[model samples]
Target: MNPSPDLSIIIPTFRREAMLLDAVHSALAVPGLQVEVWVLDDSPEGSARSVIEGLGDPRVTYLLHQPPTGGHPAVLRNRGAQLARAPLLYFLDDDDRALPEALARACAQLSASAAGVLISAPQPFGDDAQRVEEERAYFEQAVAWLAQGPSALRVVARLLFGPALLVCSTCVIRRDAFLATGGFSTTMPVYEDIDFYMRAVRQAGYVAMAEPVVARRVGGPSLISACTRPQMLAAYAESQGQYRRQRGWWEFMALKLWQRLGR
Candidate 1:
């Protein structure tokens, strides 16, 4: 029998049929890697089922989440994490395509380390994608900070106070740690990733692959836009609570002072 998959990619999609298929195809195109792609479709009527069945590819598994996820990717992603069969996990957006060679390199880097996260840059497409390039550059710069003298401190500081450093499609998360840390939040839809990252970055070292690993088709879709008022409030509240617990205010002040005083 074929060896168990070397990696598991979990994609949470809505009613985006063509894009989801493209994402799955891109995932399966990796050379010399046994990979499984799990598509968690939260679309009403389960439209994605037909798409996966038509491909008839055993490597792809389709799950129709009941009552729909209401555009909450965290809920779908958490479910995918539990059912995954690989030690290393990659989260790919339904609208993005994975770069095979870059993904292969990232997998190798993460495998060499015992407990760490892997981050790679994103190759954006379309007009809205330009902003993604700017964020990708910032993330790459922070990734470099991890190689500095006070590695963990620098990374933790940056992550706590800086702009987002995650593009799920281009990163690798260790499966065990993901589960142990409770994965993403189902209750807090918006910024659930930020909450998850705050905890994960503290627990693991990070492996950085400077090259781009995902071709993200950007049209600015997010859980934030679809969130209800209560959900948005909960998101804001939870993030503020987390910030307080982390002494974020104090740290932010210290970082600014260090920048000017050359500390």
Candidate 2:
């Protein structure tokens, strides 16, 4: 039997066969890391199974939840967490690519800090070069702030106004700590990363690494891209309310208005 894995990389995918295969390969290619790639396939037609079987990698496991779990990846990701055997859990999207030394570096950092979660910056790559460049700069700034150990309020503000640093695919958390936070919110139709990060950082504490460990494939066919404007607006409003409650309504409103006025 294969030895217990040092890290369990959970990838929730649906019908993205080619990208899923590529992600699995990238996870498996991490040098000096004992990793298991768990592909939670929520594909309606079970299309991802063939890709997993085709690779025939022992380190990879393909799980198909029958009757489909709809489009919410949070649900599928939680399911993968339930079956994970490793102590460290890394969530990677089927379309993203982890850098060659990403896992190794993350392992070293987490080992040293023993923090509940480790957040890494992601470099964007796709047809939109300008957007990618802008995203990279944003991530750099966010990581710099995060590395300084800012207060929870500051972190939330950065998340709301600055670039997103704690992307699901770029984060690694201890399995127990993840379960303690009740995993990702299934009710969040979008911005689940932001929701989870807010709670995780508060619950387990976090360490931010500035290196770009993951490559986000921008301009892809994703749930975020497909979300209607109204849907996004509603999600944003809910998130704002959550933050407002934490910071108090007056302070929250004042900060929000100040941000809007570019002050």
Q: Which candidate has the highest TM-score of all? A: 2
Q: What lDDT score is found at residue 226 in candidate 2? A: 86
Q: List the residue pairs that clash in candidate 1.
A: none
Predicted candidate 1 versus true structure: per-residue lDDT over 1-263, tens digit per residue: 12598889999988889988999999999877899999999988898899888998889989999978777888889999999989989899888899998898889888998756776677777576567677556666655654454454455555445555665676788888787667886777677776676566666766667778898766466565466898766775776566566656776566545544533
Candidate 2, residues 133-248: lDDT per residue as tens digits? 88778778778877787765556555665546577877888888899888887776788887787667667877778888888888768888888988877877786777678658
Local distance difference test, each candidate: 0.76, 0.80
Residue range with the least summed lDDT across 10 consecutive positions in model 2: 254-263
lDDT, candidate 2, residue 13? 88
Number of backbone collisions per candidate:
0, 0
lDDT at 208, model 1: 69
Candidate 2: the clashing residue pairs are none
Return the number of clashes found in candidate 2: 0
